[model samples]
Target: MQAVDHVTLATNNGAIGGGEVMLLRIAEALRELSVEVTVVAPATPGGVAEAAKKAGFETVQLHVKNRLSWMWQLRRWDAKHRKGVLWCNGLVPATATWGHRDRIVHLHQHPDGLHRVLSALSRVGAVATLVPSAHMLRSVPGARVMPNWTALMPRSERSPGPDAPFTVGFLGRLGPDKGVHVLAQAMRLLDEQDPGRYRLALAGEPVFVAKSKVEQVEQALAEVDALVDRVGWVRPSEFFDTIDLLVVPSVWEEPFGLVAAEAMSAQVPVVVSDAGALPEIVGSETGMVTPKGDAPALAEKIARIASGNEGVDVAVQHARWAENYSPTAGVVRVRELLDTLGA
Candidate 1:
C-alpha cells in the first residue's frame, strides 16, 4: 500500500514458453506502483523481457542454464540486491529467508517434473504462489489463482468489418501436442466441404527442437497449404488484429492457455480443446470448445463459426475478459501478496 523500493522478476525465455507475458504484466503494474523493478534472467529475449526493457526497467543477465544453476544465481542476486520483494515469476532458484517471507512466485503452467519441482520449491515456507487459473491452482495446490493480465492492443476493439474474411487464427507454440496437425486436419476437412468458406491462420513460432516435425508439417501442408496460412511469430501488439476467431486445439491439458483469454479480450470468439484451463478459460460466453484431439468436432465448430451461425456474442466475451483479467485486477492481487512481504 505504501511506496515499494524494488522488485526483481525472473522468468523463462518467452521464445520457449508463456511465462513472459505474466512477467511483463507484473513489471508494468509494479512500475506503475513506483517500484524500481529489475529483471534478471538468461540471454534469451522477447515477451516480458522485451516489454520490460522497453518500459525502462533495469535487466540483469545471467547464464544459468538449468533449474539447479538458475537457483544458485537467484540466491546470489537476492543476497546482493535485497529488494523490497524478490519476485520469482517462473522457474528459478531462490532460498527462504526472513526477508522474503511471503515472497512472490508467479506460475505459468508448467508440465511433467517441472511443475512438481516448482510446487515443491514453493512449499518451502517463504513463497506465496501466484497462478493464473483454477486448473493451475489445482496443479500447484495452495497457489493463489490470479488472472493473466494484458495491456489491450490499441486496435483490439476494432470490429472485423462485414467484408473481412471469416478468419480463424491459432496462437502459441506449434507442436504436435499443441494439436497443430489436428487443427490442420480439421481445416482440411472443412475446406473440402466448402471451398473458401473460411481462411485459417497459424501464428506463433515453431518449437526450436521441432525441426524435423516442422519440416514434416510443411511438406504435408504443401499438399494443401493454401487452406492454412502459417505465419510465424509477431509482436504482441500485432497479434489480435488479424483474426475474427481464435482456436486453441491443444491435444494435451494446458495449464492456463492465456491465448484463450487474450482472444476473449480482443473480442474474437475462441474454440479450444476441453483440456486443462481451456475449459475454465473458455466458458460458454467466451467461445465453443471441442473434445481434445477430436479434429472432426473441431472442424464442425469451425464450419459453424465461419458460417456465422453460432451467434457468439462478442460484446459479452470482451466485457467478461476485461472485467476478470485486466491489468488492474491482477496487480491488486499481486500487491496484496507483496503487502504480506512487508513491502
Candidate 2:
C-alpha cells in the first residue's frame, strides 16, 4: 500500500445510480475523517462528476463515447496520473484498475457467469474486496461486508386513518424482478377474501426496466387497477406518510434492501420477502416476511395485518433500530474500514 494522502473514488456508471449514490456518501464519510477525495466518472452522461463537484470534491470527467470507453480511459488516467488509494465503486472501475495496488474493490451486486470471472480478476493485489451485505458472501465468499447506510428522516409523518382501508405501499421500480406483479397478485387475492379491505400505493415507475417486462407487470396488475394508486417517483418521507405499511417483494435476490431500511427509519412497518439480504436488513423481530413470489402466502399475511391496527405497534421501536444505518453510523463504519486498511 502507498501513502494515504487522499482517495480517488471512481464511479461505475456515467449517470448516477445506487452505486453512484453510495460513492457520494462515501466521499462525505471520508471528508468527515479529513481525507481528500476526487471523484471520477464518464463525460457523456456526466452526472457523477458534476454531482461530486457540488458535494465539494474535485471532479474528473473521462471523455468517452460510451460506458466501455470510459472504463479503459479511467484505467489509463489512473495509471498515468492519479495518486493515493483508488476506490472502485463497482466491477467496472475495479476491473479497469485491477493492476494497480492499494485499491479497494467494492462489489455493489453479486455477479454470476462471466461477471463472476471478472470479479475474481478484479481482486488481485486489492486492499479489500467489499460487498454490501453478508448474503452476498454466499457467492463472493472472499469479500468483506460493507453494509450500505441511509439518511434518517427528522420525524415520522405517518398519519393514515384507522377507519380508512389498509394501504400497502411499495417504493422501487415497478418491474417483475422487484415483484410488483407478485404484489399485485397478492392484493387481488386479498380483495377476493375481503373486498375493499385493502389497497396499494405504488411510489415508483419502470425507469430502467425493459418495455416487454413493464407490459407484463402492468398486465398482471390490471386485475387490481381500481385498488392501485400509482404515485410515480417520490421522496421516502412523502410516500411513507400516505400508507399504513411498506412492502418490498423482490423476486430476485437483493444485494441490499435499502428501501426497507428507509421505511423502518421513517417509522413505517415493512413486509419483505425472503429474497437475499432483505431478511438480513429487516430481521425477524422488526418486520414481517413471506416466501418470495408466493402470492397466496403474501395475501394471507397482509390480510391478517390489515384486519387490525396492531401491525404497526413496533413501528417506533423499529425506527430506533433503523438508526444503525444512519449517516453517523456510516461514518463510524467507514472510519473503521479505513483504519483496518491502514489508510
Candidate 3:
C-alpha cells in the first residue's frame, strides 16, 4: 500500500475535553512518526482551533454557526482536501465526513436513541470505525477497540500511611453524570463513621451542562462543605500530590476513564465505580471497584483503602499502566492501525 502523506484530525466539540485531548495527543504522536498532521475545528471561541494552535499545531478553522453548519463546512473541506486521511474524532465530525473513502470514524461515547442511527450513518464509506474500550464496542458492532493513554507523570513517593488523614480526591467535571454527588454522599457517610478520618478534595468545574444540573451539583457539594476542599482547577500532578486515594464515581458509562489511567500511571491507588470501562482500565489488583451509583458501596471501598485493608501495590499499578495505558503503547496501536489503512 502507498504511504499516507498527511492526516487531518477533525474534532466535533468547540471546547477542549477528553475527546479533544485525545485528538491532540494522537496528532502529536503521529507527528513524531514523521507524518504531517493538521487539526480542523470550528471557528468559534472556546474551541479546538485555539487549543491546537496553542499546542503549536497547524490548524484550520471553519466558520461553523452550529452543528448543522459545521457538518456542511467539514464536508466541503473534505471534498477539497482528499489527498490525505481524514480522522473524524466524534459523532459530529464523523457525520460530517460521511461517505468519504479515506476516513476513520472514531466514537468516544456510546450512542443511544437517534444517536444510534447517526453513528451508523457516520460509519458509511469510512475505512474503519474505532472505539476506546471493549465495552463501547458492544454498542458499535464491528468497531475496533482502541484503549486510551495519558501522558506519564514523574513518579512520586506519596502514599497514605497509618498516621495521616486519608485524603480522598475527585477529579473530572463537577456534573451529576460524573457522580460528584455520589462521591460527596460517600464522603459524608465516611465522615459519619469516623469524623476527620477522611477528607474530600475536589477539582474541576462544571462545563457544557444545564444551569439546573450545575445548581444540583452545587447543592450536593454544599451538604458536605465541611469536609470538602474545593481546589478549583489544578494540574493532574498537583491533584495527585494532595490526595492519597482517587475516586472516579461516574454514574454514566465512561467510554474510557482517562483520570483513572492517569492516577494509575502515577502509581496512586484508585477506587472506580463499575461503570463502562473503568473496571477494565483500573483492573482488579491496582484499584477498588464499587457498584455504579451506590454511595454506600463507594464509601465502603474508600474506607477499606483508608484502613489499609485493600492490597494495592503501586509497583503493580505502574507496570499495568506501562504495559497497557502508556503513551508509547497507545501510539504503537494507532500507528499500526494507520499503517493498515495506509494512513
- The best candidate by TM-score is 2
RMSD of 3: 2.0
Q: Which pairs of residues collide in model 2?
A: none
Ten-residue segment with the worst summed lDDT in candidate 2? 309-318
Off by over 4 Å in 2: 285-287, 313-323
Model 1 sits at a Cα RMSD from the real structure of: 3.6
Clashes of 1: 1
lDDT of each: 0.70, 0.86, 0.87
lDDT of 3: 0.87
Give per-residue CA lDDT, model 1, range 1-343, as digits (tens). 3444788776655343566656777888887777788887665444445666676889776665665665666667677765566677664533322244436666676535755755575556445677778887666777787777665544445566676667778887877778888888887888788787767777877766378877766665565588777778876447667777788988777877777777776676778898888878767434588988888999998888777678788777667667777777777876776666555
Q: Give the TM-scores of the predictions, in the order they appear.
A: 0.84, 0.95, 0.94
The TM-score, computed over Cα atoms with residue i paired to residue i, of candidate 3 is 0.94
Maximum-lDDT candidate: 3
Error of 2 at 248 (Å): 0.3
Ten-residue stretch with the least lDDT total in model 1? 93-102
Instruction: Give me the runs in candidate 3 sitting further than 4 Å from their true place.
Output: 159-163, 285-287
Q: Cα miss at 63, model 3 (Å)?
A: 2.4
Candidate 1 local distance difference test against the native: 0.70
